[model samples]
Target: MVNCVVKNWQGEAVGETTLDLPVAKEENAAHIVHRALVRQLANARQGTASTKTRAEVRGGGRKPWRQKGTGRARAGSIRSPLWRGGGVIFGPKPRDYSQKMNRKERRLALRTAFNSRIEDLVVVQDFAAELTSPKTKDLVTALARWDVTLEKRVLLITHEPHETLYLSGRNIANLTMILATNLNIHDLLTVSKIVATDAAIAKIQEVYCD
Candidate 1:
């Protein structure tokens, strides 16, 4: 078990919480989570874009000219790749980007990500820092008080999207916000550190626990 210090709104350490490392240390947690999130992100890709191939393009079925009659070079179809406005060759086609992963695998991946956060000993704090208005300066100032600067990418996880917080952090190049329920492996792997709300941590435990 490892102790995670929790802080209050004023950036003060209010208490400490213990987390079981075993749950986070499953054999392939990282791999599973990475796979799951990769699948999810892949699915989110816009694969609907499609282009016409020579065979699929209109006005391409007939030979452009007689094979031996004209002085012009032989041409198979008007839509040939060599012709202007011709169909594309080996172009992109519409497809479903979604891939499936087992429910257990998804859960494990999520647990692994959470465990990674714990291992990193990311900071968890109360939600009292919610801003009434969107102001990047205020949010930066708040984090500065905790000795967290804008130099590194920070992931701010909350129970839900707080407009004020969202707006405040939107202007800062190094800060990003994400909802707890939508947590993903990339965010965990890429961010310099995580700043999660207490409620978000509880929700994570509830969702990942076996």
Candidate 2:
């Protein structure tokens, strides 16, 4: 077990909590993390690119020239690939780029990503933040106090969604909010720093530490 500092919403370090290294100590953590991230990014693609094929391209009703004769390669139709306004050949078509990994692989990948950021992890002592109203400045100030900068891209993981917390961080350019249930390797690898509330940390341990 490795302990990381535990802080409050005000950014003051109150104590420390031990991290379950068994999960973090998984074999080949780095490789698995990379694979998972690649899969996640690939899966996010829209695959909307499309092009007209010979059969779909409008025209081609009649042959431009007879098979034997006026030569010029014996034109078949204006819509033929040989023509200027013809359909594309070997063009990219819409497709699913998503890659799938077994349940064990996915779990290991997530663990690896969390392991990679173990050193940069900050556990908020408060189980949940209490905010009466949406206030971006207050959240921004607290993060600044903790030295979690916007440039590094702070990712806040919570055990459950909080309306106040969500509203406050919505407009922040470099801050993002996600629940522990939806946690994935891609977001983990992209952020420079991670802040998890006490509940979230416990959830991570419960879900990933075998």
Candidate 3:
């Protein structure tokens, strides 16, 4: 168990909480975290890219010229890949980019990500909308009070989705807010620090520690 100072919306140290690191035989926490992050990022992609092939191109019905007799090269349709403004020869087509890892591997990856963040973890006593609106400015100010700068990518994990908290950090480029239920490997590795609410920590323990 590790004791960490818990801060409030004002960025003041309001209390402290104990967090337990999951015990596992895996020693390469960094590698696990990286794998988890890769998997999550892969899943996020829509993989909707598509391209038209030469056969799909329009205006290729007629041959440009006779197959023979003419001095010109034997020609196919004007929309052939050899012609200008033709369809792609071997372009990418719409497909899924989602990669699947086994449940055990996914869990391991998440555990590794959590371990990586442990070094830079910051706990918040609670997320009270009354104290701060879901504005980037408010989040920035609070982080500043805690001496956490915008230079480092920050992940704000909570037990549940807090509209104010999510809205506040939505505009921030490097700051990401997510609920514990949605926690994935990709977001965990991308962020430099983890700022978790007390409830979130408990939830993580409940899900991963057991």
Candidate 4:
């Protein structure tokens, strides 16, 4: 097991803890990580974009001009693709972009993500970082102490919802709060650093560790 420090809200290391080797460590799989990332991005698409086909466009019922004999080229409906306000020939329609990965693959991808960010992962003991009020500046100070710039994206994970923490992160555009239960490979790879509390780490191991 790899040992990592548990830091206080002031960013001082108060103690150390061991990462559950099987859950937090893994053999790197770049391809699998890419695939999982793609799947996640694709799934996030609303896929609600739609366009009118020639058949669906109104005012297309009447033929615009005679089929032949006129100096002008033979014409069909004004809604033809060649004309202005014409319907799209082929366009996006409502669809489901969601993709699925097997359970084993998902677990592997998450573990790989954890391993990739091992150096950037920090575990904070619950009491050391507990917040009773929602203060964005306080959160910023805490992060600055850890060398995690507020300009860069940071993922803050907790075992359970903490009202102050959630609200504090709301004002910080670059900071995001997520529950350990909702943790996925996408956020892990998207952020520059991860700050997870001891409770959150325990929760993640409980859920992901075999």
All candidates: TM-score: 0.82, 0.89, 0.83, 0.91
Q: Itemize residue pairs with steric clashes in candidate 4.
A: none
Ranking by lDDT: 4, 2, 3, 1
User: What is the clash count of model 3?
Assistant: 4
Give the Å error, residue 36, model 4.
Answer: 1.2
**How big is the positional error of residue 56 in model 2, measured in Å on the Cα after superposition?**
1.6
By TM-score, the best candidate is 4
C-alpha lDDT values of all predictions: 0.75, 0.81, 0.77, 0.81
Q: Quote the positional error of residue 193 for candidate 4 in Å.
A: 1.3
How does model 3 fare in lDDT? 0.77
**Candidate 2 per-residue C-alpha lDDT over 1-210 given as tens digits, one digit per residue, 9 for 90 to 100:** 678888887778898877773543446776777788899899999998998877889989898778885656777778877678898898889999999987778887787678778878878865344577889988888788777888878899999888888889999998889998889887888898998887888888887766
Better of 1 and 3 by lDDT: 3
State the TM-score for model 3: 0.83
- Cα lDDT of candidate 2 equals 0.81
- RMSD versus native structure for model 3: 2.7
- Encode model 4's per-residue lDDT on 1-210: one tens digit a residue: 678899887779898877763542334588787788898899899999999988888888888778877889877899988889998988988999999988777877787778678898978877425677888888888888877886788999888877787777798988888888898888898898899888888887788776
lDDT of 1 by residue, 44-97 (tens): 898988999887778878777899978999999888888998999878898888
Clashing pairs in 2: none
Task: Name the lDDT value of residue 197 in candidate 3.
Answer: 88
